[model samples]
Target: MNFSEIKLVVIDIDGTLLDNDRRLHPETMRVIEEVQKQGITVTLASGRTFISTARIARQLKIKAPIIAHGGAYIARVTDDEPLYEAPMDMNEARELVALLEASGYYVKVYIRDELYVQVVTEETLEFCSQHGIYYRVVGSGNLSELDKNPLKIVVIDTPQGINHVYKLLEPWKTKFNICRDTDRGVEIVKRNVNKGTAMEKVCAMLKVEKNQVMAFGNEGNDLDLIKNAGLGVAMGNAYAELKKYAAIVTRSNEDLGVAYVLEKYLLKNLN
Candidate 1:
């Protein structure tokens, strides 16, 4: 494959770009900078909220729009307006949130780039601390009068708990794009929305074709992202299922997986 033809790079955050400890590897950071300097547009495509993704983009000095909310929301790093979006229906979001909360699951709602929760947990605090962001607690635990519609909903629990919820929401499978993005998390977005469709919107805005894009991911939510890219590279730590769609499988995130590929395939071309 002529990787030189790739003009855009979209990377997933959690397990593919961030090491297990949830930190960006120095080599990964350096390689990203180098690739950008080489005139290749590199940006993030993550299941994180716009605010969280923007935080990382700032760290990387990436000015491009980020695909956030697992493809439900997309906006530039510094812009308040969306380049493209598919926010969920407020009625549907509120009902689902109520059910999940009533079931004792830790639920977080994202609306217009901010995180909204009824209560803060050890898990939420630890996650926010690592990402350097805070959550907004709805004063009355009411999302009815929020300023914006929700972009996505997240449920965090034990892996077994996640399965229980998955089965519970099975009837909603046709109503929304529900996914098991992590061992302890289930992500919900509007139907027909996923990272690949979101990337297509980004490509459309940038005038880049699908075959000109390079994407990287390590989970089920990333399946379409990996399949759509001209060069979809899966991390060694990725699930066996995700690896199947990748054009190539790189090292594990802890081993500077992304940088390994960039150094060998893309950066070496600079010579």
Candidate 2:
């Protein structure tokens, strides 16, 4: 497909745009700016927090809506009011917390406006410090408080442990969607929240057709977006499942894959 026909380009950050060093390539930024100049709307759909996603959006100078928290939240880059949100129900949130705690995993609950951690473990504390995630530490004494509402539940653990948790919660898969972020962190959100759903909302708001959209991603969580977009571009280093869903495959993030695709497909065709 000729990417020039795409009016909106949705990209994932961690593994699609940023290299292993967690830095955006200069070429990628150039291509994004060129695409914007061509009047194509460029936005990010990621599993990251708005605060973190905003940093990259600012660097790319993207002014469109961003789908964050794996689509549980969608907000305009310059607006404070969320365009859409699909937070987990209170009971589901509590059950998730209980399950993680019982499995000996550290958990953090993300509410619409705040972040809550039942008890901060050494690993979780270090991860927060390194990632600059805003969070509050609530010891075991505050477990009862978890009955409050939540947007999603984030669990930090090894890949194996995460897989185990996924299996244990398999029965609830229909009620909630589970995904692993770039940091290997697992998250559970309301069933309706996902990159594809958020993209659909943004497209509707903009009056853009799905056939006019292009997307790039690199993880299992990105599968829906990739499969749904007209042109689903997968990073060469993307997960096997994600790559299978991609309509086209490009170089890895470190190789400036996003930029390569833009220039070769979107930019060149625009002119």
Candidate 3:
């Protein structure tokens, strides 16, 4: 493919841009700036909250819309208004909370744009700290205080515990979109929400075509975004399933894989 033909490059955080140590490589940021200088738009598509994603976007100096909440919400960094929001319905949120509670998994419910933890455990707190995420404690007795409207619900636990929660919620998969945000946790959003759908909205707003966009990712959740992009570049350390969906595969995140791919395919092709 001709990289010069590409107009937008959407990159995922975590495994795609940040190394396993959770730090963004300085080289990757430089390559992103190079691509922008070529008149190609660069944006972030992440499972992180808007607040978290915006911090990196600002550092990268990106002024475009961001696909956040695993594609459930898309908005520009300079504007608070969301171009699209696929929040989980109140009934669905309540039902999911009841089911997770019945299954005995300590979960965090995100409602009213706040993260509420059922019971703060050491592991959960560690996960939040490691990922630089913020949360508030709300014990079982305060479950009623969970926002009536929630964007999503997340269950944080060991891999085995999270697998158990997934099984327990299997019956409702058709009604909700369940995904593992990390090895230690799973996130549940509305069934219709996904990165691909959110990217499509951003493309429409920019008058860009799917054939003119490239995306990079390294997770199961990034599958749709990869499949939807004109050229899907997978990190070498990405899951095998996700790699299969990509048109090209580059080095692991720690090796500045995203930067390598952009330079080889996008930058090298530019005049």
Per residue, candidate 2 scores C-alpha lDDT tens digits across 1-271 of 6565799999998888899888888878988998999999999998777777777898999998998888889998798879887877777667667767776777777765456777667766665664557778788635435756676777777788878777887888888998776445777788967898889889998899987999999987798898889889999999888888888899999899999988888877878
Least lDDT summed over 10 consecutive residues: which range in candidate 1?
139-148
Root-mean-square deviation (CA) per prediction: 1.9, 1.9, 1.8
- lDDT order of candidates, best first? 1, 3, 2
lDDT of 3: 0.83
Judged by whole-model lDDT over C-alpha atoms, candidate 2 comes out at 0.82
Error of model 3, residue 39, in angstroms: 0.4
Q: How does each model score on TM-score? A: 0.93, 0.93, 0.93
Task: Put down candidate 3 lDDT per residue, 69-161, tens digits, no spaces.
Answer: 888888878887887888877776787787777777787776524567777788767766765577888777465446567776778778999
Per-residue lDDT for 84-164 in model 1, tens only?
Answer: 889888777777776776687778888766678777778778877776666888744464446567888888888999999
For candidate 3, list the clashing residue pairs, or say none. Answer: none
Question: Backbone clashes per model, in order?
Answer: 0, 0, 0
What lDDT is reached at residue 72 by model 3? Answer: 80
lDDT of 1: 0.87
